[model samples]
Target: MFSPKSVSAALATHFGNALVSPAPSPLTDEERRMFSRLKILLTEKEQGLIESEEEDEEALVQESGDSDSDYDAEEDEKPEQRSRKPWTKELCDKMLEFYRSKDLEDGRRGASQSFKRMQNRFRAHMKTEYDLTLLRKYEKTGVIPSVRYSAMRQLASDVRAKLGEKMKKGVPIHDTDIRKIALDLNKLNAASGNFKASATWVSKWKVHHRIVSRKVTKFVTRKATKDREKVLKQIDELRIKFLAVVRKNPGIVIINADQTGQVKEMHSTRTLAEEGSKDVVVEIESKSATTHSVTVLPTIYLDGRQHPIVYVHLGEPTGSLPAKKAVYGNKNLVIGASKSHIMNREAAARYFKEVLFVQPMPKHMLLLLDSWSLFLNHSFIQGLVPKGHKVTILNIPKGGTSLAQPLDLCYNQQWKCVMRRLNDAILVHDIDFVLHTRDNLLRCISQVYWAFGAPMFKEYRKYGWYRGGFLTTHPAPFVTPPKYMFGEGSEADCPCSEPGLIRCPYCKKAHCFSCFVINSHRCA
Candidate 1:
């Protein structure tokens, strides 16, 4: 198969050229030390005598009379030099066992926890007998006990894989889990006098391996899901019914009412400080005495009108004070007194008679209410119903108040924020001024009404109705079962006499006692 030219070229090439030696490449000091370490390690391995990187380097440098040369140059450059140690299989197993034994009381994995006691015990055991010390770098890096990089890497990968597999199986991953695993592995391998890993090794591994921390959120409960469906269906039905009513009576008022409490405490308004100063102190009202608050019942209509704020102040009613005189000119704000500083059935009924009833209204009206016992009371319902007003007791789906209630959704928070700012201004002017005194507190609240009440209520109208939001479709009781149906029965005959007598705190239902006992534990 050979051509004549190829055969001639092969015959002309001399085979004796293969025997000629090439020039030797001289080894650098670094290369020489590395080769020397390799040689020592290999020999020691064969003889079943393990020698560490640090020990071998030291021996080689002493033998070469170049202790200060490039042999130790690498260690000198580092902030801290790593001293490798030999680890036995026994030591590695012990570390793993120790970590496995350590667990938090709540059953969370505590293997990677860097407690002082854990580190001290490890250090003591290593030094007392083995004449070895664990480096801070190794403690942070989560390096396994073995001096060999390949072995340590494999061990780390195994532990990480186990953690990943646990997570896949629905086990919650804590930030400390990885550290615990590394610490346990290190402890187990300590008997062999091997270099253990550093605490931050897992952090590096997470970044390099693309591991990310994710927030754990609670899954939607079955009851919440059912409530949502029911609420949506009810809202649609109410929209149809309400729209029809609106067509019949164009001026029929649609109002949502709820009661919230506000304490007579001041928050920060403004601070005078230099631009660069990180810390600035604005004195807030300290709890030197028991703080008292007034229950505020605010109502907003679909047509952007806010009824007078009903401030239920604690203590008996004394005639008009300076605060009452200041607000008497407006005639829009009202204050009432309650023994407990909370709105009761009497207070609510009085509010309807004095504030809501007096407000300009059409023959027909819609009253939106929550599942409060006072709102669902017999007297409250009778007073509103006989007067020919529609009552739609909105059964705010469980955990749906923020979404369903117009006041809770945005208005109250903004109102409170504004009130706090006002209170802060008052306190800044006079720190010794007491806001809990009836006159001063009422004055502050009256100011809040003047500053924020009108504008905030206007914004509430937009959020609740104009757009395709929660209020676009009315939240009627058609598809959803209401907690209490107004005018259904007399509540006075009941033993508890309160509408919330049969209410379950756990499942948030107002029903018969037998029903409450059965479903009261927790909703499915």
Candidate 2:
């Protein structure tokens, strides 16, 4: 590939100088090095390996003028930018990869991620992107580890085939699962001791195989499958009825309420780390956190108003708080309890009698709720309400919550995102507060819900109403809270005065990754 005109002329000058020297004269070091280079050029030119014009003895004499220094300077660098410490570790960030990003989502990641993070603070690493690019080149040349280019191609092919076979068998495919197979194949191919599956390589394999990450949350029943058209008809009917109710009481309070179990650990799967960094470690309060559960019923008001979540824990909601943070015991959430760590009929009835019934609620209202077993008991509910209060209950149809419920559109996901971020922050900062405990979970949920109800999330509320077939007008200029939260939309700095780069899902204010994780992140 070295066919520069200057380089060809420089080589001719070296040969001419050597020929003109006295007979039997020993060659100088420079002349000897130039002759070696000249010989390589001649051999390649004859083999048609280079595109440069062929030069004979006369041509060498005619093309003289350039010096050896100019020849060395004019030579283009080799395709490899700089030698990397051969990829010796496993995992995506540090491993060799070949991700072909075609779509905006993937392409935005570029050849590498944009930011670098450390345990203490955010540090800017300028050459990481360049390293990522070089890693790709090394992968192509079979200079990475000991496996050749042909062997890698075969490994990819084998992994893809294995994925298909597993999918056909109804087995789940996880990101780590891909690495497991690659490691096995690497051993089979006799790869060097440094071989590790690059996270990027897995991504490239995913892209090439048309695979994407997905959560499995739903299943089809035989009866539903057989009566698919009937099910569709039913869904349409439910939507029509729900929209009618919305139209009927335009000014009345319409509350969409449902309960969900909180992720015991509450850690986010995503995090910011130094690009090309291996083994990002995230710690949590305890593994037992995932074993216990707390129930929360978050509601979305029609007018983007705030509401206290009704949270439940086992026994009574009681626990000790740090002396410095005793405000956690305040009325941020309506806390209740049950023997099974959820609201049962008895626990719910008691909560209604002691907490909800005592509130000065609107005289006339409509409640949109799911068909929880307890909610289906009309007699029990009617007996608890005051005689004059006009609280109409409209139960969301069975299996209709997925489509007909307003909060399901996005608000629930956003709420969870807030908690996930906070939970991870707790672990990252090593806060002593055990979040899964009844008292601490109550306090955190209260803080999160307070943030969640902010006016910044008004669009999220409107989005749920609009997408769930309840809104007559378009809620334009709104964004999905979860996706938007991941962006650098915050205009302020973190409490620590760093430039904000990530927005709080609930507060919609940006904070640098360090402040968000290390410092206590709360609504300002």
Candidate 3:
């Protein structure tokens, strides 16, 4: 046996000093080129020598260990090894074929178990020399080709297409569609039966198709032209009646009354514009204060005029003299207390004594004031009405004055005009002039009056009377006049004898007696 070191020394001696040289550095260019080429050839030769030496060592080990006796022992062991059964390529092929066929009756029951056993043995053998992973490529291509699965999927797709086409063409219909069609046909048959059962029996006409051809008819009822015309005429009559009623009572007056404190320090101012200018503005101002000692009850009448009257009454522990004197000194208007104001006889007497000093007792004057506690519940009427004069109290609903009262209408209109005037005034004189001139106050009063008076105008129009005429003339004073009058007189004295009267219904007169009397009375 040759030792590695001895073999290397012998080879080195045979090759000489040329075989082993010191590594070069900073060689000439030509020497560098030559050395590079020789290095590559020497590396290949060294590799070949190393492989040959390994082969020789293996051969020597085998030769020295195995002799005739060892060969005989190995031969005797080979039979036992053969009996142990090593897996061969033929065995693998046969096992794979049985697995692929799935022939269990042919004695390959546990194919997966047999496959695992074969894989282990083959992998052990391959690991001794080559890698077993290389068999994975062969298994993929030959044993389990992916194209077979793809082919099966393509066959299923073709079957589905054929079935879909058959379904579309109304051949081989689905069970559900067939059931639906049967049910529909059955319904049709039932309908036909119902028609046949109700149909009249005619000997000559036995045409079933003709009867089936008839569709269900829907009867639509329509109004006749004559009926429509009648309805239209009725509607027109109703419209005319409605119009007549509206014309008869064209306007309505809503009244609202609320009271405020005394309008303190009332004053007015006049303004002059440029010489040729048409504008002349007036301003007014007033102030008020609140006090707990004296309760000033203001009665605001919202009819044809927005007049707010104030009455001061000393409340709680205050004597009648102080209250009465205070009210009298503050305002010209005075009201007397009645028995109703008395909580007791003493209070009644005291109230009477104090109030009587300013005004006579039992004067029934209707105060058109707002609905306040002082004005409501007939407090004012009971307190002020004289013993003999009958006081009739009227209360307007809340917020209704704008619609029912003459004063609210007038006030609204006047206020609107005043606002416009104030705006114009401000534009001309600047903001400071508004405060100094008291234009805002004047505008407010004007607006209130306009709002109150508008309702009166509307009422006048509705009643075929002029508001201006009534206001200026002061007809009937505080009371409304009666609609009719009658008197006994001879034809000569009676106004009915005049030529203007033409057989009046009430008097059977040929002359206009009522008109003549009305005109005369008004003039007087």
The model with the greatest TM-score is: 2
lDDT per residue as tens, model 2, 377-452: 7678768887667666777666666666787776776777766655643443224556676556666666556556
TM-score of 2: 0.49
Q: Could you give me the TM-score of model 3 versus the true structure?
A: 0.20
Model with the higher TM-score, candidate 1 or 3: 1
The C-alpha stretches of model 2 lying farther than 4 A from their native spots are 1-231, 246-250, 269-285, 308-327, 350-360, 427-434, 480-486, 489-492, 496-524
lDDT of each: 0.45, 0.54, 0.29
Query: How do the residues 240-268 of candidate 1 rate in per-residue lDDT, one tens digit apiece?
Result: 66566667766667777767777767452
Candidate 3 local Cα displacement, residue 194, angstroms: 99
TM-score of each: 0.39, 0.49, 0.20
Q: Model 3: residues >4 Å from true position, as ranges?
A: 1-370, 386-390, 431-524
Q: In candidate 3, what are the lDDT values of residues 126-183, reduced to their tens digit?
A: 3211122223323454432122222222222333333233322223222222222222
Deviation of model 3 at 436, angstroms = 7.8
